[model samples]
Target chain A: SAVISQKPSRDICQRGTSLTIQCQVDSQVTMMFWYRQQPGQSLTLIATANQGSEATYESGFVIDKFPISRPNLTFSTLTVSNMSPEDSSIYLCSARVASGGRGIQYFGAGTRLSVL
Target chain B: AQRVTQPEKLLSVFKGAPVELKCNYSYSGSPELFWYVQYSRQRLQLLLRHISRESIKGFTADLNKGETSFHLKKPFAQEEDSAMYYCALSNSNSGYALNFGKGTSLLVTP
Candidate 1:
């Protein structure tokens, strides 16, 4: 299993301000994913970040709103732009590793963002 | 579109009692399912996956292709087992990104 570290475990931001969360993995991974969990809601995929390519955003998530950067295999960053109260949620970073011919994902502790 | 469903929002069980967490998924392709658990104040971790057919923390889940369900079960529930469990599905169609269900909060009391 791969260990993951996320910076800014918790943050408080004012409305209209932006915050970027960083995810660092111990080992190189092929794919990294970003997810958001709102209060009392399921984890929703924000985007898929691949090294050396553009990110693939999920249906309801747009790059403008949630920009992602995967500069390398071991690190990725997700930025919540133009933040609002609705954007306050827990953001998680996940990396996939191959095991038993299947891919298993490991997650970070998550960054809890509170926008006021 | 792939979707994972966990019917119960919360499940309470007494220590040493049997426990089951229900999960169902909808997908056209062969689905790969996983059970992830999040303890209080901890990161989400993988408990088990259907393909492995191995039990972790005395919990097991079997995938029923006909009924499209994968339910996690344990014969004896412990107080430490209380946590939020999420059912997820991943397939090639969605680029292998997990589609997670609304998690179920398990409460095991002494």
Candidate 2:
């Protein structure tokens, strides 16, 4: 199992501003993913960050709105640029590591952002 | 395109009653299926995966390929079992990224 730490468990941000959420893993991983969950909704994949390369975003998500940086195998950051009320949601960071004879993906506690 | 579907948005059962959360999927080929759960104050966590064929917290699921379903079931529901449940599918052929369902909110009342 992988231990992931995410900062700013909850925050209230004004619209038009940006916020960066950090994710740190206990060990190096091949894949790091960012997800978003709106209030009372399910999670949706935002992007995939692999160290030393550009992040691959899913359909409907763009790098301009959510830029990702993976400086190293164990650390990654997601910045929500030009926030809006629609961007108010729980952002989660997950990492995949080979463990217990299987590759498993574990998630962080998530950072809840309420954009006004 | 890969898609997951959770037919029910909400499922309620009394404590000690049986519970089942339905999940269906659409994929070109065989895919990995998993169940995830999230408590009110906790992060989303993996409950079990189809390949593992294991039961977690008395909950077990069987992947029926012909039926195209993986339903989560437990004989007795506990109040602690109340959580948001999601069904997900990941095909290694598709780069291991998961396609998740809309999710079902389970409420076990005492």
Candidate 3:
């Protein structure tokens, strides 16, 4: 398991503005992910951050809306572009690490974002 | 496609009482189940995974493949046990990411 640190625990942004959230892991990992939890909803996978390559996004999400960057093995950033009131949610960063042939994912504290 | 379902949105029980949070998932491949908990003002943490076959904080969940369910149970609920519990399914073949249920909010009143 790895410890993750996310910056700007909470932020308030206006519609059409964009905000970037940073995620740092204590240990290097192969797979890092970004997830969003809307109010009163379950967590949804936004994208998978790949080191030194473009990210892979889920069906409902797009790179233009939620751009992701994995600069290295231990750090990644997710930028929510063209923010809207509907984009308000808790954004969490997670990393998948291998342990004894098992893959386990640990999550960060999450960034609470509100788009006015 | 993989999907996880948690039927109850909120469950209230008195302290020392037995508790159970139901979870059901739909997946085409072999299923991997997990329970994640989030206490008030706390980060979400893993409670237990089906593969580990272990108990945490007096809670245990058995994977029932036939039923496509992994329900979390506790013989005696404690005040500290009250939290939002999420049931999730992992798709190993798909590479990364997890499918999470809506979650259950447990309330243990003393």
Candidate 4:
């Protein structure tokens, strides 16, 4: 299990403003992922953050709207650019920890963003 | 493409009653299935995995490859079991990330 933390646990922002959510892991991980959970809905993978490289965004999500930066193995950030009311959602960060023969993924306490 | 499907959006059961949460997957290759639980105000955590074949918190799930299903089941429900449950799948050979289903909210009432 990994101890992960996210900054700005909850935030309210005006429309058209951008916010960057930070994810910090207690130990180095092989993979880091970003997800978005709409109210009363399921989680959607936003992107997969790769250290020292550009992140891979999922279908329906673009780099220009949600830019990601993973400078090191233990830290990553996702910036919601030019936000709108529809962009309000719980953003979660997860990491894969090597264990046994395979690895298990763990999630951070999500950042709940409310775009007004 | 790998995908997970949880049929129920909400399920309610009384304490000591049996509970079952259905989950199905669509993937061509071998899949690693998992059940994740989120309690109120707590971070989501892994409850159990099909590969491990270990029961956690009196919950057990068996992978039926023929049916492409991994349903979570328990004989007796408890009040503490009220929470959100998500079914996830990962390609055995693909990267270690998961494709999650729309979670099911379980309400175990006394």
Candidate 5:
């Protein structure tokens, strides 16, 4: 399993302002994913970040609103553009690692975003 | 597509009692299942996976393919076991990310 670190652990921002969240993995991994956990809600996949290529956004999510960048195998960033109160949630990044002939996913601690 | 459903939002049990957290999933192809836990102020971590069939922290989950379910169970609940548990599923053939269910918050009292 890979260890992931995400920053800034938490933040408060005004509406219309954007925030970029960073996720770094201790080891190189092939696939990385971004997820959103709205308050009292289940975790939802936002996108899949592919190294050296544009990310694949999930349905109901758009590149214009939630842009993702995967500069390499171990690092990725997600930016929430034009923030709104509804966008406030805990954002997590996870990776799929090969273990015992299967893929196991591990997640970062998560970034708690609060929009006012 | 894969989807996981955890019916209980909260589950409470007294210490030394048996505990069970129900989970059901839907997927067209072979799927992998997992249980994840998040403790207060702690990061979400994997508790166990169906393939391994191993117990962690006295918790075990058996995959019932016929029922499309993987429910977590612990023989003797402890106060320290209280936490939020999420059931997740992923496709084995593709790189599709995990689909998680709404978590169940477990409370074990003395």
Candidate 6:
């Protein structure tokens, strides 16, 4: 399994300000995903970041609101643009491990964002 | 539409007692199921997957395609087993990104 590291484990931001979260995997992986977990809610898939290409966003999510980047196999970034109070949640970074056979996704510790 | 449902929001049990966490999923194709656990102040980690048919930390889950469920179970509950458990399903069409349940908070008391 690949170890994922997320920067800025927690942050507090003002409304209308955007925040970018970084996810780094210890090894090269084929698939990277971004998920948002609202307070008292289940984790929802935001998008799948494809290496060397634009990310595929899930329903109810747009690239403008949550732009993603995967420049390489071992790294990806997700930015929550034009933030609001509702945007406050835990943002998780996950990767499909090459060795985990059958593409098991491993998650990062997640970034807790509080918007006021 | 692939979805994972964990009916119970929380489950409390006495230590040394048997414990079962129910999980149900909806998917048209053959799905892969998994159980993930998050201990206090720790990252979410994979506890077990149905394909492996292996028990992890005294816990095991059987994928019943007929019933559309993959409930996790343990013979004896341990205090340290208390944590947030999430049941997930892998949709082959979606690059294997997990569809997670709402999660069940298990509490083991003395």
How many clashes in each structure?
A: 0, 0, 0, 0, 0, 0
Can you give the lDDT of residue A99 in candidate 5?
93
Residue-by-residue lDDT tens digits, candidate 4, A18-70: 99999999999868999999998888889888676778888899999999989
Report DockQ per prediction, comma-separated: 0.94, 0.74, 0.85, 0.82, 0.86, 0.89
Model 5 chain B poorest ten-residue lDDT run: B90-99
Instruction: Provide the TM-score for each candidate, comma-separated.
Output: 0.98, 0.96, 0.97, 0.97, 0.97, 0.98
lDDT of 1 by residue, A62-88 (tens): 999999999888999999999999999
Q: Which parts of model 4 have CA positions greater than 4 angstroms off?
A: B92-94
Output the lDDT of residue B31, model 3. 72
User: Candidate 3, clashing residue pairs?
Assistant: none
* CA shift of B87, model 3, Å: 0.5
lDDT of 6 by residue, A1-116 (tens): 78999988999999999999999999998799999999988899999997977799999999999998898889999999999999999999999875446778899999999999
DockQ of 2: 0.74
Q: How many backbone clashes does candidate 3 have?
A: 0
The global Cα lDDT (0 to 1) of model 5 is 0.93
- Point to the candidate with the largest TM-score: 1
- The docking category that best describes candidate 3 is high
The most accurate candidate by lDDT is: 1
Candidate 6 similarity to native, TM-score:
0.98
Candidate 3 chain A, run of 10 with poorest lDDT: A96-105
Query: Docking quality tier of candidate 2?
Result: medium
DockQ of 1: 0.94
> What TM-score describes the B chain of model 2?
0.97
Window of ten residues with lowest summed lDDT in model 1 chain A:
A44-53
Q: Which RMSD values do the candidates have, in order? A: 0.7, 1.3, 1.0, 1.2, 1.1, 1.0
Residue-wise lDDT of candidate 3 within A36-104, one digit each (tens)? 999988899998887877899989999999988898999999999999999999999999888657778
**Cα lDDT of model 2 by residue, A1-116, tens digit:** 88999998989999999999999999999889999999888889999898878999999999999999999999999999999999999999999887555566789999999999
